[model samples]
Target: MNARIPTDLSSSLKAEEDSNHSDNPSFDTVLAARLSRRGLLRGGAGTVGTVVLGGMGLTACGGGDDPAPTTPPAPGTPTETLLGFGAVAKSLADMVVVPAGYTASVLYALGDPLNAGTAAYKNDGTDTGFENRAGDHHDGMEWFGLDAAGKASATATARGLLAMNHEATTDELRSSFFLHANGGTTTLPRPAAEVDKETAIHGVSIVEVQQAAGKWTTVQNSAFNHRLTCLSDNIQLNGPARGNALMVTKYSTTGVQTRGTLNNCGTGKTPWGSFVTGEENWAGYFTRASTDDTARGGATAKSVVSLKRYGRNAGSRSRHGWETGGADDKYARWNVGQSGASLDGSDDYRNELNTFGYIVEMDAYDKTQMPRKRTALGRFAHESAAFGKPVVGQPLAVYMGDDSRGEYIYKFVSTKTWVAADANPANRITTGDSYLDAGKLYVAKFASDGSGSWVELAMSNPLISGYATYAFADQADVLVNARLAADAVGATKMDRPEWCSTNVNNGEIYFTLTNNSNRAIDSASMPPDSANPRVYEDTKGASTSKGNVNGHILRVKEGAAGNAALVFTWDVYVFGAESGAAAGSVNLSSLTSDQDFSSPDGLAFSPSTGILWIQTDDGAYTDVTNCMMLAALPGTVGDGAKKTLSYTKADTTTLSVDTYVGQAPTADKLKRFLVGPKSCEITGMCETPDGKAMFINIQHPGETTAMADIADPTKYASQWPSNAGYGAGKRPRSATIVITKTDGGRIGS
Candidate 1:
């Protein structure tokens, strides 16, 4: 998610580093066998797409060929057509592009002052006071509206607070070069000042913004404006894993407190009106010496197993080399190696990595409230935590995904039932404690029949209690090492599940499976399965990419219309592809030029209209177009039928798979809404209660520029925000853009 380019590391390689190499059966194989048993696999094929299972109608990868009956709208629900605006054409421009009749304006940008005392940003790589300025790489966000009285108002339209994740900064040669004068230092013993600034920008920011005279601007000195950086104090730890022996670090001897959040990627708006963010890719921030295993009791030790399972193996280099900055606690905390005499890890930062990888909750309206890490959700490369629709007297359920190749999807059901009054509780953090602290964490296991079951990850589960691969000492261990527990229970591996969004209309959940490089048609270790069944090569100019090059969206409907249901039905909602891709296989969704997109990442359903907004962070298709955002009207899980795809191998033999595909989206139901600036990712979206105003983040524009060329504006991949006449200099900055209809009507209408 950072999308930051380093000299020795490419984005694709960084993604591959966290891949799941377990031997769990893939959904592809399961779906193939299920279709074969149903007598649906066609004998000879280049790519056969029709396969009727039971009474469901089937069709190839062609949209509008077979229309299925859709679930009628709920009582009094809006019956308007889904996408109302004309599609925005693809662009390679250095500025944001939206449909005609819409105006997009920058609302916030990196280095912008959050307080009146902070000096205005010059955008010349010499800015400081990041703790009081907008951070880099604005990501997954939520809007908290405020009424005229300056109090919380769920339906307010003219004023609100925007809480977003500043995931990471652009880094290369051991420095976040974009934030320093003359590109900073690129060698070992990184300057403490440079490290300080970098650390101050890698967390979350909550800033107030208001509309006045038809223009929107951030309230620089508003009381609601606050920034939580890696050096911020008083972030508490909650849930079952809190105070666990494995979590004891030098900074928190009791394991109940830790310093700032890092790599805050996808975000969630809690049912109790709190802001929750997922710490993603945090493992790469800590340096583990090669002798860590030896010091901690060798290869089979629990600490070693846990560290490796979490993708922090020995000798792993820190992403920005912050640990080499000196002996101060601020710098030393980045080192997770064993250096102290205490065996329980309370004397050093050996357990510092465990403090992160959680769903952190904070009351955006109250800056005094300390953010709390909800550990019951089970730690991994968390992308987002999307809660199911709350029904009074029922247990609350939250869905999450581990954003890595071959990882599993997880769900947490709170033991306590929801209460309507708690929606506007006296203290939001306490309300979060009631539901998020105690829960049953379950991992998904998809079967071949388009049905899946949630496998509990508690010690009571025989598979977990008896797991020989990694012995689980207690529930805390199970939650801390959730990946291994899911592996033990035979959970189905997904293709890099990124963000989960719940449809307000029907409560069905949608997950964006961002593309995976590890997938292959002939790989013995990781082959294409039914659920992840695309294996083809895509060439953008001379650079060729393969293995599910364009990701797809998957949706699931919980059984019995209950969020806590253990069983569910699922289907591939849409397969991302170029409109020109070969039909039936590569272009399974039959996407037209107006509907094609790759690497679906940020996903959120408008609570006002139930329209699902999808944003992308793609590399595979950047040669054709910059990352984009699309608006879609999705149907329920069983609305479509099953289809079988055949991939030809190098031996000329074909491997066939049967997969459940959702009804194809017509142009009216799905269309491109916006395209980002060059070399940037379009992520994080939120809307006002009236659906008249929309906000999206353009992250890391001009990110492809070489590190050595930081001083040359001519060589930058993009100059946007600046080119658009926004900031002080030519350097590009990640910023939030607000879009509204010039006709004064609801957006997309």
Candidate 2:
């Protein structure tokens, strides 16, 4: 299944190029620019009664009795000692579990200074003493290696580079919305000083780390350490959308570059040691003023037509509008709709909104080249773009997901096969374009028999022309408005699909359906079937929350159709649950303390060892256990049994979760490996090429804060590594935790 990076697939490229050039979009009256924006992102549960991760077993909830509690069983069962880390109880909290013989430590934490001079970050959001530094909510990550003697300074870690993503934030004390001494509102637009900090906090940070006794350590201030932030003095843009009219603004006449990237999420590391980060949900940044979103009259004014497509028709507030302070175009260009008449696109921000949501590539070793946004990925909330095994002269293919309710999953297959030397800078993006910028985009439609098809999202397709719901203007419009196009094509609606990981041993794609609650029983929305199980209420903790919280994972086999092919096979792999929950049949595999979980998110399969690793991000069941990591030995498609899901919906209608059910792992199959700190997420899995050191991001361990309690230490939900109270001497910030064996053996050995 390895794809050559040089393969060409030009016939399939879809573009959403930037239509403006320059920082200011205020003068072109004929093309007046208004920032079009609006979004009420529901943070919890699925729209359906329940959404399973990559593998949810039951198609529908059947009447079954809850298992009664019994006397505690023995410590060990029939589990494999080699795969099981062993069951070990934690010292803190009511009950956070981990595998046996494994230990967790804080490599670094929020507000802890990486270098000597810079002051630590204060959770109060008042750490004015800032240069470039690590931000909150570290989510995705990757690693790079250097020789044993490659240290740049005496204080540097042995040798290696670490790149991590800070996904999003839920800052309370720093913001006026969560509480209030700051007038309960942003008193004014962000000042340059504050704007500067905000910008600095948004991009990726590259740091050097070395290993000792199998454990990795950081190299503070190594020349290789660098931060790429939102307020990056400036960056050059490249690609079909680079110098187009849609990209020009008062800031840059050439229209080939922009200042920063946002919503950096899931990652992909190349065979040549490069890193690809996706910018998801970028459309929400621009502020649109006009109510009308008409595209006719070629009218520059926002019309109802254009507004609905981009989720911004009018009367919507923009996100973190730091641009509101000054009339200067530098601050004004953030808005994207139409308003003023500045010519040459200087006053039109509408087109610029099209510039983001791309797959940006960066050479971990060097940052000289301006990262290019792979527009061919079809702009949406890109979850993560992962490449299949790369081989010389083989077609290059990448799998990606649009992280939103009712969106589609896509893959890019190159027309030109990959070449070994194509790994260099001379071929970096240009080479990526030969493959990335021009490949077919397909939407997955799950079938009733556990089979699926990759419906091509092409404008000429009958689904596009024959659709009764919407019209496709062109390929550009098709990809830009991909969701509607997907629905029109009858793409199967999933339950808030999130991160996707590939099983390297078998090239199977595993994704998480992180719970859903919006699904109205029998409503116009897609109904739950055997593939998307559950339609009942969950009563784990507080009951105010409704819908399914426990999730499941979906596993698919490539079936040699290549990434762009139309046919594939799939099934449910694992269902997250609480230990003593329900029917053995409903519980699927009858999960135990080692495998019990809710809302599985991050997943990865080791290339060197072929082991599938899973991580969780739970809001529904944290009251029982903190976030955790697990290990599994998974089989490819066509290897599981088939069964239909059937259930009773909240409205009394019966529904099913999926087309085919999955085989449950034995009691010893999946086991808990590690647990993370309080209020933090354990994400971004990666290991040394040799399978030694492992790295994971501990994001925002203590993220909760209130306006009035900003100054109180005890009110802090979590005082992670420092344990010194909220932002005490040190600010509570997200940090990467490194784990390995003290005996110099393979992890989980």
Candidate 3:
């Protein structure tokens, strides 16, 4: 038996962006003057007009006097680029220009069909079986292999299981507009067929893939390949939220189970052979009943408070509008309203929104067991939870980041430690249940001195209970609305926390801060500390549009105490910016042509190879280059030179400069390995256990391009996998690409 699929259904939606955050922080022309020094480098083919700001000046970019390695290997070969940058070149709109001797290719993409019976995908937005095939918006992924002869273990480049999260589907392609679908009300409610198909397309899909010779192929016959969708009929809930009064609805009077999982995003591959897929952005799926809110069950004001914190309650509009379609509860449940005379919770089953945003677990090698939602993890827009292989009796720990504008990062330490994988089959799932069912959920509070603390959100903790902003109910409620709880505890609001990955070797953690425009120099926003130091205007495109710069990666380590209770030290390992931007003595690493990026999104630490794969989906710099992925060898959290950043506030209080002591993502260190199609985001990558093959997901190839414009293939924005000749024409699909060396050599050196 392989992984189980989660059936717990409820209501959840995307975390709402805090409107109270700093909207636009004003920056001076001086910062812009510094960026002007960045040299504009030309991009490769098809990027005639693309030019990037390279070779940042002021000694900070290339700040070190280190020379290029005397014995450099051939170009396009795996010569692991360390986290601290060296002499790598950064260019605009170009082919992946790596350090030397590294090779890269598309392993999979959007429209490729997995099974033998499925027809080939047409790159056009129009394609049949796409629902049963691969969905769009691929995010986190993992690689698991079958034990075989000559299997290279970590080095095995042959075959394995590929599991992925679909994240969010864009309306730019599928013609489903949230506010207005067709032209009028007649076209309203969207076709039930479309809603069903789209809902069916939203969950997680696990498939077995094989690498023969140098090419990787899908093993369609493998029973392990299964799909989990929101439309699935038999899924149930099994956490603190399950059977809770909040989860009660018309569908399940017992409140023990629900329907399906949605917004399945960042994922974690387990030491016990299962995968944890988090449901994010689930709040957008429901419509709150406005009228009888106070009357139904005569619920208290606090009951409604929970709904609002999680993006539910009365006056909420259904983006999908599936509720307007029919009188049957199947379609009407999406409406989320309480009405009628029936004494049961079924009358106007609106509380369905309470059932989403959970971390679901599934075994990769087995398919007979349904996926299970491990509720103890505490829900939000969970990005990913990374854990190392468990040793017998060790605390089964996993790290996570909530993907929202002002969310916090977390770590789950199991009450029951680890046991051998198959030593006790009878208590296997039970062991997992006990460990994850209840535990401490801590929010990160980064301080200026480079040390941070995991503030406990347990209601009994003074930080949570004593806060005046909101009340922390219990562990279940704390997990249900973790964001609000984290905010009340004064958790450090980061630059949009995205993904968290712990190194396979040293257990160090790295997380991506995907840009935050809400940051400012004001007291409430960014108060200019050494951690979140600079507050500058990052203008978008050719104009001075005010917003946050791309974003940076944060690395942290535990203090004296190795447990979650101890304070941790941290540093900004790398900041996303164009080399042409201004800089002083502070910005530690000297960014060059080979290693400059904006908005680092997907973060991965390949345990087999000890390589950090940093992928980018940048709006701040996409005008110059396509979204890209790079490889880096990261040092421990505090392993870099320390520099201070100074900021002067209007209130006459001078903010001392940020003190950064970290390795730079230099040219020779962080080099681009691959770039995505023109209008798409390059996300989700995993290779064979042996390192011979790589699987990269290209999501929404023509995401930003208009549908009307994409109708003509010749004028299409992205020629992706088709351009690489995986199939026929240049229709772009968000499928996973299988990348391997032509000579079948080991990946990144």
Candidate 4:
């Protein structure tokens, strides 16, 4: 669902990178020359090398002129161990198909009751009180166990609080609910009640769930069961932008607080006990009047540049018309137009757009506390915030990805180092305030030779201060317009970076670049780089799709400096492609028929087993198989050989695309573990501390069906979880499922 919005800034930024690097030789050219000279080294000829922060190089062998260690001093053993589970056959069935020994059951579904007063979900579209029910399009989620006293418990597996994000909505119209009047089009103003119901279902859900006798059920009326929507007043703004003049609005004239979180996609858990929810695709949910740009900025070049770079240009209408619901400020805030008094722009919601698109941190144990927007993490289309292994009295690192094509990866190092006593603290918000409230953010600039550097995004940087279009006034300005700062520093444009997970074993980081359609569309956009090595055709029914449709996962090894490391080595862990494609071409991993997948979206490493779970949200190769999830046992970087692909150009010429491919996947290494129902995406998953229960989210089933067929239940694209005997209807709904091994052993073992 995050890929729905088309990124307009992608091409412009790609073009900027092309022109910026035209005069200076590219990183590939420099690395190629270095490798050519190191050809004499027996094992270092074709492998990825390391590049230090100050333009120094280290060969794979220990013979480079620069004196940093050629081989990274190895870290301690990983916290998790691999539990090998045999592969499950791929399927397009209208059910969740897991491996031979696994059994899955619905724990909760959209419209399921969260309060004791609400009736069970009818699944017939007449259900209401979505404010007290499960939200739709569940994306990222995490588990925080609770003891009998209702505090954060690390090992309490049977009873715990499950916090999950409801990212977006499915297109299936509800005929019974009045919300579907006129097909629920955003072109016209919607009814207030209809809009209120829709708004209530678009945030995060915190529910208390328990498993007894192998059955998981929601604890209705539990105090922990609550929902936070885009309309909740309990959300607060923190960090440097808090109380800043740029954030003043009618809702929060002091700029210290605002209403709810929006479009929460991926989620992360802090070293202290809290949930870090990434707000993504939130820019497309606000409306800007046709004349808003010039009137708001008033010829200020910096203001205009910041507005356009964040896709807040005038005449832009969001995907919904919540602004048209009524004259109330609750709905009016959705419209970011300059309609009211303009002297300070505080009478209207003109500054409301600046409030969203942040990583919101919430204390899972303390529901009374307000959610804080960690603005120090830089504002962008954040996909996830993964913290590296914390060291006592050492700095903490949080990695994040902006989930738009041609965006950059970011790292935030806390100003306050980690203190061992802070872990499992009595109050997580206080811990968050100490570490997350202040930090130095850095953007990644990857090179072709499997090496990279972190460019700090500071206002003190000459490149940021001297940026021609946007002038940086202070740290807050740079944080507010993070994309501009990343562009000024020339960070490597990734292919829609998504969920990131740090290897608990070695503190190595991995992120999903969830495909970019703009790359190589023409000479105007970016061509395939060594990092993103695919720009081939993937044909679907009568139409051919280009660009990296089948996305890949990247592995990063930080230098011995650990969380604060400025230099790192990297390589592609695996490439997503059709199994039957050319062995070494599009299917770079040499996947077989049963192991193939596309658009690797949701990626999580099991804390108990260390197995990597890769989920897909694909339309590229859906004709042959539905979206699915796989279990992978990945080797470290540089475990495989270099790869090269010859691309036949439009003019009948050929271009060679060479990249560092990781070890080839085998049946035992990476295998399909589960296939989702038709039209659904397998997004988020989490495991119990004991590793007995695994929770997975299936989102947006029956999404492809036409809204006009709402009256005909038979025309629905899927009847999942319901047909699987959970709910009672032919309509499909997003639901959370629990998977466990039949033998009562740890999952995937």
Clashes of each: 3, 110, 82, 1
Q: Best candidate per TM-score, number?
A: 1
**Superior by lDDT: candidate 1 or candidate 2:** 1
Task: Name every residue pair that clashes in candidate 4.
Answer: 78-505
Worst 10 residues of 3 by lDDT: 1-10
Model 2, global lDDT: 0.56
In order, the Cα lDDT scores of the candidates are 0.83, 0.56, 0.60, 0.75
Q: Which digits, one per residue and each the tens of the lDDT, describe model 1 over residues 132-170? A: 999999999999999999999888999999999999887
TM-score of each: 0.92, 0.80, 0.83, 0.88
For 1-749, candidate 2 gives per-residue lDDT tens digits of 00000012111111111111111111101100111111111122111121211122101110112123345446653222345344322112311223323333445444344565677555455554333466545767876767666622212334578777766554332232211223133444655555555545666777777766545566766767667766564655554455666567656667777767776878887544567887765555456664424422333432334444455545434555656747766567776656556655665555666666777777666667566666666767776677776667667767877665445577666666777876654545445556666666777877766777887878879877666545555675666556656766777666556678777876778887766553334434534544565433455433433334466788777656565456888888877766545533234546765467777777887765677778777765665556777778876666667654454544665444434446666534566666665655667787777665677776655554444555665775655555422234323456666665433445654
Q: lDDT tens digits, residues 422-509, model 4?
A: 8878788878999998989999988876788998999889989998767887887788888889888888777789999987666778
By TM-score, how accurate is candidate 1? 0.92
Better candidate by TM-score, 1 or 3 = 1
Q: How do the residues 1-749 of candidate 3 rate in per-residue lDDT, one tens digit apiece?
A: 00001111112222243422322221211111112212433333221122221111001122122344466558776454333232223333223233232334445455456677778765443455655566656777888676455221333446577888776565532233211223113345566556665665677777777766545677765666667777665556766666666667778877777776778877887665567787866776777666756755444555465566666657666656667666766787776666656554656575676677778876655656666677677777777778744657666667787766555688777667666753334433444566667667777887756777887777787766775555666666677667667766677766667777887767778888777654556545544445555556654455542334567788877665454444788887787766555545223465654566778888888765777888877666766677777777767787786666555566655555545657775544566666665666767767776665677776666555444454466665655555545565555556676554434454555
Off by over 4 Å in 4: 4-84, 171-187, 297-300, 646-657
- Candidate 4, residue 50: the lDDT equals 28
Error of 1 at 653 (Å): 5.4
Pick by lDDT: which candidate is best? Answer: 1
Tell how far residue 505 is off in model 3, in angstroms: 3.0
